[model samples]
Structures are given as C-alpha cells and as structure tokens.
Target: MAIDLAPISLPATADAEQFKDFGREILGVNPGGMSEEQMKEVHDLLHKYSVLLFRDVDVTPEQQYNLTKSFDPSSENHGHGNDFSKTPGRKLFELNAIPGVPQVKLIGNGTVYNHEGLSEAVLKHPSHTTFHKTHVSAEDTAKGITRFQRWHMDAALYDLNPPRVTTLYAKVVPQGPHQTVRYDDGTGDELEVPLAATAFVSGKTMFDILSSENKSVAVRGRVKYSPHPYAWMATAHALSTGLGIVSEGLEMPDDELPLWDEDKIKVYPMTWKNPVTGELHFQVHPCGVRELFVDPLPAVASREGALYPDGAHLTNLMYKMQRPAIAPSLVYPLDWRENDLILFHNRGLLHSVVGELKKDQIRAFHQCNLAASDEPAGPTPEDVRKYA
Candidate 1:
C-alpha cells in the first residue's frame, strides 16, 4: 500500500535547528512559551520524538489545551485528573469535574478496584495507612495497585479513525520522588519482538487479531470495560502465563498466571505504518510479547504435545532469524522528571515504562493515542536504519 507521507512542515517562525537537538537529548523541545517560533518547533519536535517534555512553562490548563491545538486541532479530553484533595492548583485535564464524584489521585499508593472504581474503605483511610499498613500486605497491594500503572497506548484499543494526538499536562508533581518513564519506537532505538510471536500468544495472527471485524469473537459477547478494543487483547496477553500474571480474575487458575521473564522476552514489535506520514515504526509496550511472533513452551508439558500447535512454534522460530534483519537495538529508554510533557509516535516506536521507581515516590502522566489507520506491514532493514 502507498503510505501517507503528508509533510507537516515546521512553521515559519520555528527554529528547526534548536529543536533538532531535542531529538538527541529528551523527547520534548523547549518551546519556552507561546512564541510562534517556539510553537512551531514544538510541533516539529512532536513528530520527531513522538513524546515532548517542557519544564516550568507555567501555562494555564486552557493555554495548555490551546498549545496542543498547534499539532492536533481536534484533541479531546482524556486520562486521570489531578488529585484535588492533595493539591488544589493541580488539574491534570481541563474537563469539568463532577461535584459528588470523589477526587482522583495519581499517586501509586491507592487501591484500584476493577473497572475504575475505588474501594470506599480504602478511600476513607490514607494511602499509607490503608495500603501500607492494614487492609492487605503492602507487597501484595503494591503489585495489584500498579497493574493499572501502565495502561496501553491510548489509541491501541480503539477502532475509531485514529486520533491525531494525545496531550498530558502535569500540574502537581510531588517533591523528590515520582518520575514518568517513556520509550519511542520511531527513533530506531525500539526493541523488536517478531510478529509471529504476537500471533502465537494471541492464538491468532496479529493482523487478524487487531482487526475491528474480529472484536466480537475476541471479546466473547461481554461488554468491554474500556473503549479501546485492543485493551482486551493487551490485558489477556499481560495476564497469560508466558507473559506474566498480575492478579487473578474469578475464573483464572494459579498456574495459568502470567510471569515476567525479562531476559527471555525483553520486547514486543508491533508493525505500525503511519498513513499520514508513510513512516514505519516497530512498537513495543508492556503487554506480553515473549518472543517476536513465537510461543515459549510452558514449564509443564501437555499430553497434546505443546500448548500451541507446531505451526505456531515454527513461525516463532522463523521470526527469530528475521530479528537481526530489523536490528533489535533500535529501541531507546526515556528518563523521567518532575514536570515533563513527552509525546511519542506510538506507531513508530514500541515504548514501555521501566518499573524502576520506589513505592513512596510518584510518577504521574496521561496519554492518548494519535488516531490513524495504517495497517502494520512487516518491518524492513531500511525502515530501521532511517530512524537509527
């Protein structure tokens, strides 16, 4: 297919040179403020890095929304709002907050019941008291609480026409502790796990799996919790035994829980070709992709031979050889700061938030997937080299 390569040129006043270094240092460019040049540079940097970070800009929530308009005119409100109880000035998103609705807090210490509901008992007590000391052991509570810490790429779950951009503005960053981590797939620094591996774990080819037509079969007639269609697949993969289990649902078994073997499966490669820009990026997320397009044998063997059929195994092994062709090292790590705004090309890069921070420290950020529908094709050495 002829990919879309519409040129989103930098605005006339923007200094392309000043922002080019942003691609080298951090995901965001220093747009300083509303200067025409700064705004244009910010726009260019958004396309280049896929994620941008601006520090101490002090723009109001309205100005922040206006700033996002430079890149995406149709940007909408999404992601968790700031914790009003803890910090009054902090409003993560500009949408109107309801009166009786409990204030939302972004700290990692809170309890997350299924479907975005918070436990009343947990809410009544302080996070440190309810979670750290009593209700459940802190260790167990920590694991359960952090399950939602890294949600999927905002757009990955959707079947709608792709959104243009997602913006996250942080108003309250705690002192000395919380930091957000991000990864970019477009920069040629993304880790590549093959397509075949994704198919094996999913029990279907990645292409057939993500198609909107298959949503009914994949979800099994139940109403999906999130609007993002891929959310179910990502959640299933994350909960699978090979991938690594977080907590158990009523029907899942203990042995079937997912396990994280970083050494065995360090990355997942999703084929994303941008329709507007014709650029291809190999993307990875925390969702469980053990081997590029391959299935790993379970610790226990089944009488049926392997958990997956032979075709799955062969496809996975074959994709392994192709890994060298894509240059797996194209993935890069994103460091976090107190007040950083980072935007990344989700289709171009496989990104993840490395679990490196301590419990007490907080890392808060919101993300939305820029909408576009360019089907994933196999990766090419040239595509990898262009970003590298």
Candidate 2:
C-alpha cells in the first residue's frame, strides 16, 4: 500500500502551479522572529523543496542567527567575524556564554568585507602555488566546462558530522551578463538571470534517476572520500567544488593531510532512505572521494566490510554523478539577487558555485551551518568517531 503521508499545509506561495517561483520564496515570513508553528512549516517545506530562497529582504546578522537557532537550537555557531554588535543585548560574544541563541557564523575575508585586505593576504597564501593549478585562468576561461562542479554534501570531507542546514545571506551579489539555467531536466522551466548562480541537485532526485542495476550498485557501493584538509578555504582546497570567494584562511597542518588510500579514507553509503521524508537520499562527496569501490561496502562500524566496487562499477557511478546528463534537469542554479537569503537543506542537495569570478568581481555571503547531524542518507563512515 502506498504510504499515506498527508501533505503538510503550505504557505500561500506553495500552490502547485506556483512552482515557477519555487526557488525564489517559500512564502515570506519575518526571519528575525519566528513562531514555533512557523518554524515547523519551514522545516517541512525545506524537505519538500531542496532550496528555499528569500530575496530582497532586510535582516541583521543576529536576527538571522536567532532564526536559524529556532530550527536547531542546539546548533553550535561556527560564526567567525568581527561584526560585534555593540548594543547591550544585541552584542554577540562567541567566547563564553549564551545558550539557546543560535550562533551566527560570520565567515569573512571575501571582497564583501575586505577585498583589499584579502587580495594581499591571498597573494601570500601558503597554497599560492597550489591554488593556481586548480584555477580556471583568464586565457582558458572561455573553454569547456568553465563552471564544472564535482558537487558535494556540505562539510562532507570533514571528520565531523556534516551540517543539516546551510543558510547563506547574500552580502554582495554581483551583476553581470545573464545566462539561462535549467531548473530541472528540460521538462520544467529555465531561469535566466545575471551574476554567478549556485547550482543544486537533489540526492533524492539523483537516486530516482538511477538504473536498477546502478541502483543496486549504489545501494551496495562504497566510496571513500579523502576531504582535503584545507577544505574550509575555497581557493586553497584541492578539489574543484569551489565555495565562491572565501578569504585566505588557515592552512592544514602537515599532519592533517588525507591519506591517499582506503585505510585512511572516510567511507559513505552511495544510497539510503531519508528518515525525515522517507525519500531515498545519497551521500556522495565526489570531490572528496579518493578511492571508488563497487559492490559490498565497508562494514558499518567495524562489523567487517562488504563488497567494494570494481573498476567498471566505479567508472559508471562517477560518470552518472559527474556528467549528470542522464538526469539533465537535476541542475537548478539559484539565480541570486542583491539580498537573497538562501536556506537550503545541504543533505538533500549537491551544490557548487557556478561561473568563474571575473578579475574585479567579489561575491560574498554571510553563511551558517546548523543542526550537525549524525544521520546519513545512506551509509555511515568507517571510523564513526570522525562524525557527530
């Protein structure tokens, strides 16, 4: 029998035909102050829609932090920045106190905050030479797959539990020549706009499109991701899943380098069912996967591993995810506006910064990762200690 999960009530903007504006807004409600019921609605809708964008809105960083806290109050704020609210109650002190209040991570260093400062700092970056190799140079810019994304589940590379939700508030959105991007396989509609758009594809969607043979491979497949230690800094990272313009930050200590072999690699399930929506989801960190194995996967927490992927299976799965041509419409690039606040489910979707940054362009956003979850859409890693 089909599971009868009565649909949750949606906001006024959630009408079926109104799906045209799905990426833009899920029905505007104040972010600064949210009611309990309102918060639940947001979570439901977030699961229903892969990404929820609120555009041209006014919100202070603290308010944004508070709002996200309402979703997952236990969420630790990795908020970094010098944006100290001086006002008595409004001031944010990351050092000592404050429980229940959501930690607003103020990730800085982009042009939005200190372009001149970052320019000089990045030049002296330790990875200066390495960062160059991965860069799409000016002469080679117009060539093939300029905006290629290996795609990732947020923080998938870290030995910690990946964030459940990621809220990025646009600090400075760029203006440029427009490009038309598909929302889903050509069956739906196309959005044309300017600046660099962030692309997202649902893991649930990816799972649905897999062939039965591939699905079996996915269900049984195991991938070991060796997340680059310098992953926090977008430019300095080894992989190509760029996170836009992040400031030159800390370097990975010599000891933190990921081992190239399966012994040191973090294993994750290729496919699993979502406990929240019961929708099938996957844990694919393409950029981080150092080794690919087919069939019997590593045992969940030392019970003895299962079949690993053969060369052919590994090749096929990577091609499906890397090419995504079979699921062409799965690509949905969020065309950003000046003040768009995007609250997206990082677990459900694979995101990548699309388009190359021009010489003088500096795009930055206030970002926060909330609700660290031990849950994986599919399988858990080999060493459970790395995750929450």
Candidate 3:
C-alpha cells in the first residue's frame, strides 16, 4: 500500500538544532477529515517520528474530537474524565470545555469572550513562578528570560488510562519577541524559544542515550503514581527546571487526598515499549511518581554495579536520569501559528509550556486527548534478559 503523503523533517527554527532528528511535518493535509488510508499513514508517521505537525489546518471542535478519537476508537471521553466540574483535579488544569463537544477543551492565555459558547472567560497561563521553588526574577523576565513551566506527559495518573495522543489546534497566537529559557539550576543552561512555545523532547532519544547499566535498571523498574496525582502535588514546589519536584516532602498526605481506591492506583513501567516500532522508551512523569519498584537481575546476569535491588525513591535520581534529555541542544520548541494543528504521540515524548503570556496578549486553542483503553506495554522477558 502506497501512502499519498510524505512527511518532511522538522524545519529549521530558533530553538531546533539540526542535529536532533525526531519530529516531522506533513504539508497540505486536512487533519479534520482524513481518509482511512491517510489516517494509517499519519498514525505510522506519528509512531516513527513521535510528533507530527500540520500547518494551515481548519478544524472545528467536533472535528478535532473525532480526529483525536480516530486514534483510539475505544476512547470516548476527555483524558482527565469528561465532567470537568466534578473531576477531583480539575483545578490543576485551566480548561473550559467547548460548549457542546465536551471532549475538546479551550486552552491558552488571556480572555476569550463568546468563543464556542464560552461567555467572557478569563484565562491564566501556566508559569514556573507559581510551581517552581525558585524562578527567574521579574528583572530577568523583563530582559526576555524565562523558565519551563513543567516537563510532563499529558495524563490523569489515576483511574483513567493515559491518552495515546494529544491534538492541539492553535486558533489565536500572540505575537511577541522570543524569550530565553534559563535553567536557574546553577548549570547556566539557556534556550532561545519563541514566545509562548510548546517545547518537546523525545523519549526514545532519552532511552538510547543511557548507559548499559542504567538501561538494565530502567527495564526492571516500575513507578507507582499517587492517586489523584495533580491534587496531591498541588501544594508541592517543583525544581527550578521543572523536570521534577523538590523532594522536601511537600506532597499532600495520603489521608488528606481525595477519596481514592487502592485498586484504581496506577503502577507503570519506567520504560514503555513503542507499539509500532517495538523500541523501549524511558517514560516517567517525575512529579506524579510516588514510589519506585525494581526486580533483581536475572540469576545468570552479573550484579556488579547495578541500581536499586530493593527499591528506589525520588531523591534527585529522576532528575539525574532525565535532565540530560532536555538539554537546550536537544529540545524542539514548536512556534505556534494560527490554524496550526499538532498531533503528538503522548506516550513517546515529554513536553512543556516554555514562556509566559501577558494579560493583554490573547491566545486561544482547542486541545483534546481521550483516555486510552489500555495501559502502556512494558519491556518483555526477552528484553529483561538482554539488558539484565
């Protein structure tokens, strides 16, 4: 079967370095209404590239919901549960549903009046200052310096399964000068990003760069996420770079969290296997992780210099492993334009909002992701044997 469309490597941009090769863009395709053949090609391209960009698209909220559902037919509601009003962690997300199509939510900064049935809504853009323990001062921000708001995969981390993909349609984009992202962690790292861009890093690249010993540990490790993770971390402060939390025990006490069932808690592998490529990816949402479990190496394998035979904790270990992957040289910040639709493999990458938006700089976008019907696939026994 020959697919009609061809995807090109991500174009050169201020934040994108030519050396990194993870994202692709398909030109001249209507994502809202794709034929079965086109959807297959797009799906395969997405798995292979991890992120797919569609420029100059015209899609409605209902169309966007249908397109997102096409990727996961069994999925029916929003990724965090459809009823935004009753969801426990709804406060964590600054979202407003698109009137009739509850699956698609309105996101972005500033006020949007009478939009898709929303009458006069005030939006607050996510910022590191509110979440990070330390951040760039107003003086630095005035000088066009900022920090990443958060580094995470879009998921509820509870009863519902993680979404397979997330669709974001930019309806209105604010125009402004580019800002420099400062990693205030004493490393002096910086990235020149477009104002209010979405930055992404590839999980496959993160796994491929790890040492052999770490790879073995990753394959054997499982992460237990806190129930209602967003609400649990609501009061916690993140690290300066937003890669992980400051482990000063700021997490909400288990008894104080919303009513939760033990059976509904999620425990996922540290390394998830890509369904189409069969490649292992080191995927973990550091902020939501509550506990780490690891199995001992195979009897035949050497345990010379291994990690965590008993168990592990979130004591800078996650930051040490994940920090390198988000280095400025490796990140790709997607510069948004009106009518630009991006379909990203939610399982294959970690992303973050890069800069802040002024109150007057209005930006409107429709975002949609449906809870997956199944959990992520983990490393196989053969994989454990090979690495262990």
- lDDT (CA) per prediction: 0.31, 0.49, 0.85
Q: How high is each candidate's TM-score?
A: 0.42, 0.63, 0.95
Q: What is the lDDT of residue 295 in candidate 3?
A: 82
Task: Please rank every candidate by TM-score, starting with the best.
Answer: 3, 2, 1
lDDT score for candidate 1 against the true structure = 0.31
Best-first order by lDDT: 3, 2, 1
Candidate 3 residue pairs in clash (backbone atoms < 3 Å): none
Q: Give the lDDT of residue 388 in candidate 3.
A: 72
Please give the range of 10 consecutive residues that has the lowest summed lDDT in model 2. 120-129
Error of 1 at 130 (Å): 18
Better of 1 and 2 by TM-score: 2
* lDDT winner between candidates 1 and 3: 3
The RMSD of every model to the true structure, in order and in angstroms, is: 14.9, 10.4, 2.1
Tens digits of lDDT, candidate 3, 1-388: 5444444333243234432457777876788888899899989888878888888889999999999999899899898888877776556668888989999999988889999899977887899988999878889889999999999998998999989999999999999999999998889888889899999888988888788888888888888999989989888999989998897888899899999999999999989998899888889998998887778877777777877654455434567778988888778888899999999999988999889778999989899999999999999999888887
Model 2: per-residue Cα lDDT over 1-388, one tens digit each: 1111222223232233333323436445666566777777777777766577666777776777766655567755342212323211121112211123334443322223343133221111011113322554445444322433335565534445566777877766667675433323234444342446666666766665565545555666666654442332333343332322222334333355434343433576666555567665665765445456655433332222222333234532464453442133445556667677878777776775555445456565566665353545564442121211
lDDT score of model 3? 0.85
Identify the candidate with maximal lDDT. 3
